[model samples]
Target: MFFHLNLLSVFRGVLYSDNSQGQDGVDIYGPIDGGTAFSGIQCKNRKLNLIDGSPNRISNIDVQSEIEKAKKFKPALKKLIIATSLPKDKAIEEFVRLQSMEHVKVGLFTIQICFWEFFERKIPEFETVYNWYVKNEGFHRIKQLSVTFKDGSVEMTYHPKFQKTVDRYIIPPTNNTAPDINPYTSSLANLLQSDINKMMQPGYNSIFRSTLLLSNTIDWEQLCWLELLVSNIGQAVVEDYKIELSLEGFFEKAEPERGNVLFNPDFHNDIKGYRNSNSHLYIEPRKKILVQGDSFVTGSFYIQPAIAVEAEIKLNWKLLSRDFTDSGTLIVKIVPQYHVIINRHEVLDSTDVREEISYSLIKRKGTYNIGSIDYHDKESDYPVS
Candidate 1:
């Protein structure tokens, strides 16, 4: 009705035709650019909640029915328009263009359809329509959720370890394209995009940049050179501490006879002391740090496993200061990365120069398997896995 009657005000001397039953698809009929013949419109109001990309609902079948109805009007329509509260779709556009071959007068040239996005942008009266929709039709208030860590540092301020909860609006779950869909995933995605956009700005906050990188990194070991940001998220200066990675039997010793097989004790003080899979570090209130063995290059300082293995590695740490002694444990799975080269010729008695690759070298690429998740006697003892 908004486009049927309300739009007629914008165009002078626009006529509206009504039948006895008053159920024809053509709602508004009038001269398009103030010439001779009449233009007809089929108004549609589709329920659009604007979630999951909110695809345009109108299809070719719906437009076909409208075209048939527009044919039955007393005087032939010079132009047919489909004005709806939905975006213009490719399927419907093609169908509209094909109808021109049906020999409707100047319809190929005069067909003027208003897509929902463009129409709403051009029409100021849509604000009133939307207001009415909010009042009468109502809207969903998406519940906000934050599974936050306990709001303090270990023994210094509050709890000794980080804690969180699984929070959501809906309790149950299902798999289907329904109206009552969960907005948690969509909301989180939007927040990530917002965070990324903020980071793109010049001289962004260090905390913001670290938070983005921390979420993506597999381990502190994966980010050796860079600081593993400590937002402190609390008001305490975390003293000297060490992250212990237990990779003794899993990794093959470089020098089988040597006592310190992993690190050359003479050269590196930090690397020499970390022979027992230890990474030395300290954390400050709202700052970042790089522990001893954290490395950008894989299998450099830390012990590299001989083969791929899924083992639960412990990251227990103790932060000791003059005022407070804070000790916590965070267990995580350490799985060896496997590199596979496909379509390669290796083993052979006849050594010859290979010219080109072939399908015979069909070695499959290894993927990250189901690494062991942390299992502990106490909750929050091992916060991450």
Candidate 2:
């Protein structure tokens, strides 16, 4: 069920024993004449071929012969691992055909197959084979699977269910010694020491300064800003087209001022040393504001903004987690008060309208206000029951 393959190497060593004359017996054994050699088999230089090189189809006899060869090699092998550089389709076909025989399904068959497909290779056709294996053999037995390339490797490891349960109940030794309290401070000290050494070395600081200067150049900053702007505006447009224009204008005007605002002394003073010292830095005061509304208006106002923040607009009406049909018209409008310039001209008037026609939020009474807006409808009619 499980297979592990390692590289093979042969080592020769001599077995020696102390030779001394004993009074009661003959001479003690000395070093042997012949040394024993060990041979270990390891797999290396793995490559996978996705495309079939030969026009010949693999015959059933060939599959049987391979199986017979495996059987012959079983006696001498402590662990048998098979690897194929073939494409997924060929591998799957071979695996299915080999495992299909009655003798191959026996308990003696313990060899595992490892398949790898490199870059530009087609996806493995092992889904069907895996499904069949799981259905018949169960997942508890299958062990290692790896899809590897020259640069990277991915392996699927199956944890045995029985072993997991056994490990869960197994108790581990506990240490009562207290752990290091200032690990982060110690790490920072080490880092600072290394940085000091680097800075003290001749020409290192110059190289570092040059690199930093190159990194922080205006052209680099402009390019980075442009990339950020493009990505942000593109994402905003894709997520919410209504806010795209506003986001674009915000990026254009605010980018140049970003470095000044971000690197300000006040800004640095606010967050600096807050992590090392156990002190809270209150940069801004939190204000408590009061809002009053009935339940129907309050719930709608609360739900809409919460959904809108995530770029989602809910169009369904639910009563007790069940969909309901209620006849009413609801209009939700988001109006930006700030002046947004588009195409060299400032447009002061732009409102995003979201309309919902439903019959759910009627005959309810509670106050609803989210941050700033108070949503209340005068047209709401309570049911006369």
Task: Name the candidate that leads on TM-score.
Answer: 1
For model 1, name the residue pairs that clash.
224-294, 224-295, 343-361
For candidate 2, the lDDT comes to 0.24
Stretches of candidate 1 above 4 Å error?
Answer: 10-20, 32-35, 49-56, 104-110, 125-385
TM-score of each: 0.32, 0.17
How many residue pairs in model 1 have overlapping backbones?
Answer: 3
Q: How accurate locally, in lDDT, is each candidate?
A: 0.41, 0.24
Residue 324 displacement (Å), model 1: 51
Compared with the true structure, what per-residue lDDT tens digits does model 1 show for residues 81-139? 77786666776677677676554464432345567676555544556655543443222
